[model samples]
Target: MRVAVTMSAEHEDARYPYDFLRHNYIVYLQNLGFVPVLVPNGIQNPEDYLTSLGVEGLVLTGGGDVDPARYGQENTASNEISPMRDETEFRLMQCAVDRHFPVLAICRGMQFMNVFFGGSLIQDIPTQVNAALDHRTGTHSIHVLDSRIEQALGIRVWDVNTYHHQGVHTTTVAPGLDIFATTEDNIVEGILHPAYPIIGVQWHPERPSPSPEIDLQLIRSFLDKAFWK
Candidate 1:
């Protein structure tokens, strides 16, 4: 199975002079029987490119922050904005949503989906929501609601890693979307499109998981769904 994973453009530095994908995501997908194709940062037509390559699904990987303007907000934090990456992913997501392609969005990818569906996000979780959880650098527990994720994993609660400062606004979630999991402080963690085969998790699934079995199950479930079609 060929799955297109988004890539982050690293600015030229002393060591490396060109943009490239970190091996974490590529290795993650390979473990699940997927040929991971790292997509270019700025494509003129992402859908056309994917179609030509016969990409079966999209795995939106974790990376820099999404543009605040996407969610109708002004930038007030020190978040690194990647407009080109954001634009490319938005187009890729549009094609995925339109075609009902299986999707797994992680971290900033989740935020991108929320904005694409007319949902707002907390620009800075600590400063905006004042949560007890240290979302920026702490591992925390989240309760999984009765949704796709819970159904797939057959578990209710999970302790997942965290490394983002933004989270989905539950009340402002897009129509046909449901919050499947949330932190104790009520920060959105997992989002599912009930009408579409799409799932977005705020936690980084590409990272080393504390529960290997469950993490593998999550990846397998998505792959199974994609293959089912």
Candidate 2:
């Protein structure tokens, strides 16, 4: 299966710029026997082009902060913005929803998916929420909710790496979406559309880890969901 994976653009030089993806993403998908196609920054209607390329699913990879304005907020101690990439991803998600396309949104991709669906977010978790742990860089246990994801993985609790400054909570979630997993402090870690093949996680499954078997299983399950549903 061919999967469209989002990428981040690098400012290499003044004349020419380039878009690059993380190696782990390629390695993970290749190991699973899926072709990883890059959806670089600054593309209009990316889903249309991807569909033409026979892309079966999409992986919204992690990257810079999403513009708070996209979720009805002003500049609030966030990192740099990728307006073009945001637009491309938003459109791509819309197409995915329209076609019921399978999607795996990670980190910033998860946040963007929430905001795109009329949900709000905590711009900066450390500054905004009174949390004991540093979610920006650490590992934590997430309690899986009673949902399709839990049934697919058969895991009630799982430890995942964290590397984000923003997050969502249950009270701020969009209607009709299931909160799949949450940290001890109730910070949302994963979400899923109850009736669709779409899923999002606040961790990077492709990142190097001591044991990646479970992570690989998640990806495989997602692909199987896409293929069968």
Candidate 3:
């Protein structure tokens, strides 16, 4: 299986070049018997061309925050905006969804997925939610939502690291969306399409003691769907 891992651009001589990506994501995909394709940021025709090139899955890596403008919000100085990466990833998400490509979106990647689907986000989760749990800390517990995300993870409780300032905040969320995981304070930590084989998690599953089985299984789950066509 060929998995196109989206890269976050690094500024070098004023050019968005492929210099950044959580190496664990690449190594994990390779270790799982899949070819790793680095899809750089700021590609104009990311969707049709990459899809045509036989990209079976997409791994949206963590990066700077999505420009609020992408989701109808004003860009704040506080936001680490990367318009180029946002454009590339959003387009990639659309293409993957259109082609039924399995995707693993972590942190910022997850936030963009929600925004891409017309769901709103809490611009600053810490200031807005006022939840008891510290979301920026490391290795916290999460409650799994049964019959949706749990079935996929094959576990109920997960001690995951929290490292995001933004989160999903939609009262009237998109239809057929399933809540797969949540923080102790009831924050959405995971999302899954009701019928599609797509799942988005807010935590970086490829970090710390990475879950080879879970990560590969998730990608393979998508490969199982994207292939055989």
Candidate 4:
């Protein structure tokens, strides 16, 4: 199956901005029989562009934080805001919603999905949430609350590597989305839209883990959804 994967915009040099995506994402997808196409930010009419690509599914990769202004909040703790990437992804998401395309969102991608669906985020977990788990690094246990994900993954309780500062909570999740998994501290770790083929996880399944099969299983489940539906 062909999948459109979003890339992160970087401005290391003021005169030479560029877009990049982790190569592992491509390898992971290819290994699972997917033709991974990297979608650059700042495209003209992104929805039309995605339609032209003839992709069956969309993959929102992890990157910089979503702009707080998107959710009617002032920039308090969020960093690396990419307005162009945000615009592109939002348009792509609209197209996905319109076409009922399956999506697998990771980390920042997950947070973006929340904000796209009229949800909010906890700008910074450590400063905002008291006694929060060290979400910046290390592995943490997540309780899978949804049977669909549990059945797809074949395990309910599993440790996933963490790599983000921003997150979502129960009170801040989008209306139509369900909190499928969460950490012990109650920080929202996974979300899914019941009416759509959309699954968002706060962790990066593209990265290596102690049990690599878990990540493979997760990707397999996403591919199965994307291919069969």
Candidate 5:
């Protein structure tokens, strides 16, 4: 299957900007039998570009934080906000929602999905939430609350690698989406749209995992959903 994946934009020498994707993302997708198509951040018409590529699915890769202004908030806690990437992904998401396209959003991509669906983020977990777990580093346990995710991975509780400060909470979850998994501190870890082939996780599945089998199974489940005529 062909999948459209978003790339992160970074400034080189403060003069030139370039796009990059983690090699793990490409290797993981290829191992799962997916033909990955890299999508640049500076595209003028991302929705049209997706259509042009004839991709069957979309993968929103992790990178810089989504600008808070997009969610009607000020630039309080966000870092390395990429306006071009945000604009492109939002357009791609609009096309995905309209077409009921399959999407796998990871880390920052997951937070972006929440904002795209009329949801809010905590911005900075440490300062905003009391007694929050150390989300910037190390691995944490997340309790699977939905049967779909549980059945897909064959485990209820799993320790996932964490590297994000922003998070989604139960109260801030979107209307059409359901919280599928969360950490012990009540931080939202997974979300899925019941009506669409869209799933967002606060952890990076492409990165090295303690349980590699579970990660593979998750990607397999997404690929199965992405299969269409």
Candidate 6:
């Protein structure tokens, strides 16, 4: 199965050509048994190429911000913002949803999914949702919904890493989305489509020393849906 993982673009003046996620995500997908492809952050029309490759699955890798402009707000602070990446991944994800392909949106990927579904986000989480705990900590734990996320991960409950400032903070949900997990502070961390093999997590599961068991479980669960399809 071809799983296209989105890459992050760096400033022209920056030292590097690609962001940190380009390799990490590819390794994770390949380890999970899929042919990983890194789609550049900016593409004229990503869906066209992805469809041509017969990409069986899509994984919107982590990077940057969703540009508060997307969720109806002006930038009050400076943060990583990429329109091309956002648009490309959004289209890729929409196509995946339209065709019922297995998908996993991670970190910023999950934020875009929220905005794409007409949900708002907390621009600066420090002031928006304070909970004494660190949201950007590389090591953290979350509570997964027993009936949904547990079934998807094939595990009872497990810990995952975190790295993000903006997050979901509301009882309001996006259209046709099911809440799956949250942190101790009640910040929304996981979401699932009503009936597809689609899931999003606010935490990072493909970090340097990730839990291979949980990572494989998540991918296998999504792949299982493809097998039956």
Per-residue lDDT, model 2, residue 29, is 78
lDDT by residue (1-229, candidate 4, tens digit) is: 7889999888644578999998999988888788998888988887777777789889999989899999999999988889889999998898899999889899999999999999999999999988899999989999989877887777999889899999998889988898889998889998888778888989988797755788677767765673233
Alpha-carbon TM-score of each model against the true structure: 0.90, 0.90, 0.83, 0.94, 0.94, 0.86
- Please rank every candidate by lDDT, starting with the best: 4, 5, 2, 1, 6, 3
Candidate 2 residue-wise lDDT, 1-229, digit = tens: 8988888755433367677788988998788888998887887668678878998888888877788889889987767577777888888888888887888999988888888888888888877777645788868888887556667777788788888888887777777778878887778988877777888888888886433676677777877873234
Model 3 segments beyond 4 Å from truth?
11-19, 76-78, 152-154, 170-175, 210-229
Candidate 4, which segments miss by more than 4 Å at Cα?
226-229
Residue pairs that clash (backbone atoms under 3 angstroms), model 5: none
lDDT score, candidate 5, position 102: 88
Worst 10 residues of 3 by lDDT: 220-229
Q: Is candidate 2 or candidate 4 better by TM-score?
A: 4
TM-score of predicted structure 3: 0.83
Q: Which stretches in model 5 have alpha-carbon errors above 4 Å?
A: 11-13, 226-229
Write one digit per residue (lDDT tens) for candidate 6, span 115-212.
88888777767776657357877666667764745756666556777788878765545777777777777777888676777777888777853565
Clashing pairs in 4: none
CA-lDDT, candidates in order: 0.78, 0.80, 0.70, 0.87, 0.86, 0.73
- Cα deviation of 25, candidate 1, in Å: 0.3
Error of 2 at 220 (Å): 2.2
Q: What is the lDDT of candidate 1?
A: 0.78
Q: RMSD for each model, in Å, please?
A: 2.8, 2.5, 3.5, 2.1, 2.3, 2.9
Per-residue lDDT over 1-229 for candidate 1, one digit per residue giving the tens place of the 0 to 100 score: 8988998755423265344667888877887788987788877888888989899899888767778888788888736577778888889888998887889988888877888888887877787775557898868888988556777888888788899987786666777788888888778888877777788888877787666687678768866773223
On a 0 to 1 TM-score scale, where does candidate 5 land against the true structure? 0.94
* Alpha-carbon shift of residue 177 in model 5 (angstroms): 0.7
